[model samples]
Structures are given as C-alpha cells and as structure tokens.
Target: MTVVELEVTKSADELAKTYIVKGILSEKKEDDALHVAIATCAEMDALVTWNFKHLANLRKAELFYSASLEKGYLKKLEIVTPMEVSNYES
Candidate 1:
C-alpha cells in the first residue's frame, strides 16, 4: 500500500477557516473542516472516512466542492468510505 504524503498548506488552513466562517462546518468541527481542506489542497482523489455526520455526508460534499472551487481548486475531491473505494476499484 502506498502511503500518501500529507500536504498541509496555508491555503488549506484558509479554506478550512472559510468553511467554518460560512457555517458549512460548525465551529466545533474545525478539525473536520481541516481534514477536508487538506485533502482538497493536496489534490487527493478522495477523502476516505467513516464519520458520516461531519465528514462523509453528501450535503456537505456538495458544499465543500463549491467552496473548494471558490478557493480556485479545480479538482473534484470525492468524500467516501473505504468500502466504497474498494467497490469502485472492482
């Protein structure tokens, strides 16, 4: 298994802050925002997670996608579960 390099940039932090400020993610969930922001800024293909309420919901996905685009990230980063990715690989 290849270990993905964690990319944490200033832009990523800003993106996370933006989400919180816009109420896309609650203040209590800044860490969750950071996870998505890092994945987005790193240009990862997807963010694999089990946290449905804060990290793996479709409504949040749409909002994150738009926020990322607004921040000039052109790539569409998918938020999914490990099982979902495994199935996709087949």
Candidate 2:
C-alpha cells in the first residue's frame, strides 16, 4: 500500500482547526484516523482498511455517504475491509 500526505493550505488548516475547536468536528484518534482514510478515498480510487470501529463499520459507512452528499463530494470511492474485497474474488 502506498502512503501519501495530503497537503492543506494554511487557510484550510485554520478552518479545520476551527472546526475541531467548535466541537462540530471530532478530535478523537479513531475519528482522525478515519478522516485520513476518507481524504484518501476522496482523492483516490479506494481505501482499504480493517478499522471496523471507525472506517469499515456499516453505521460509519452510512454517515460517510451522507456527509459526502452533504459536502457535494459524492464520488466513486470504496471503503472496504480487506476481507470484504478478498471474498469478492473467491
């Protein structure tokens, strides 16, 4: 798997920081980790993970879909567990 850093502009960083401070955005480690995956999926094709608690959970999936729609970021992105993708081939 390739790891890439997503660079945000100073203004964007400030906005994100403000969101965190306002309590509208989550600052939990799990949430932050999933956010990174979401960012990757938004910019790339897919995001593979085993983080069921944060990223691969069905409830979180629904939330992600809704959030993407609300943000006008409904793109062709897949967030799946490794087993889910592996099972598809079998």
What's the residue-level lDDT of 34 in candidate 2?
A: 44
- Candidate 2: residue pairs that collide: none
Q: Which stretches of candidate 1 lie above 4 Å from their native place?
A: 87-90
Error of 1 at 88 (Å): 9.4
lDDT by residue (tens digit), candidate 1, 11-43? 999999999988899999999999999999988
lDDT of each: 0.89, 0.53
How well is each residue in 5-34 modelled by candidate 2, as lDDT tens digits? 655544334434443454433676434544
* Every model: Cα RMSD to truth: 2.2, 5.1
Candidate 2 Cα deviation (angstroms), residue 70: 0.8
What's the residue-level lDDT of 37 in candidate 2? 37
Backbone clashes in model 1: 0
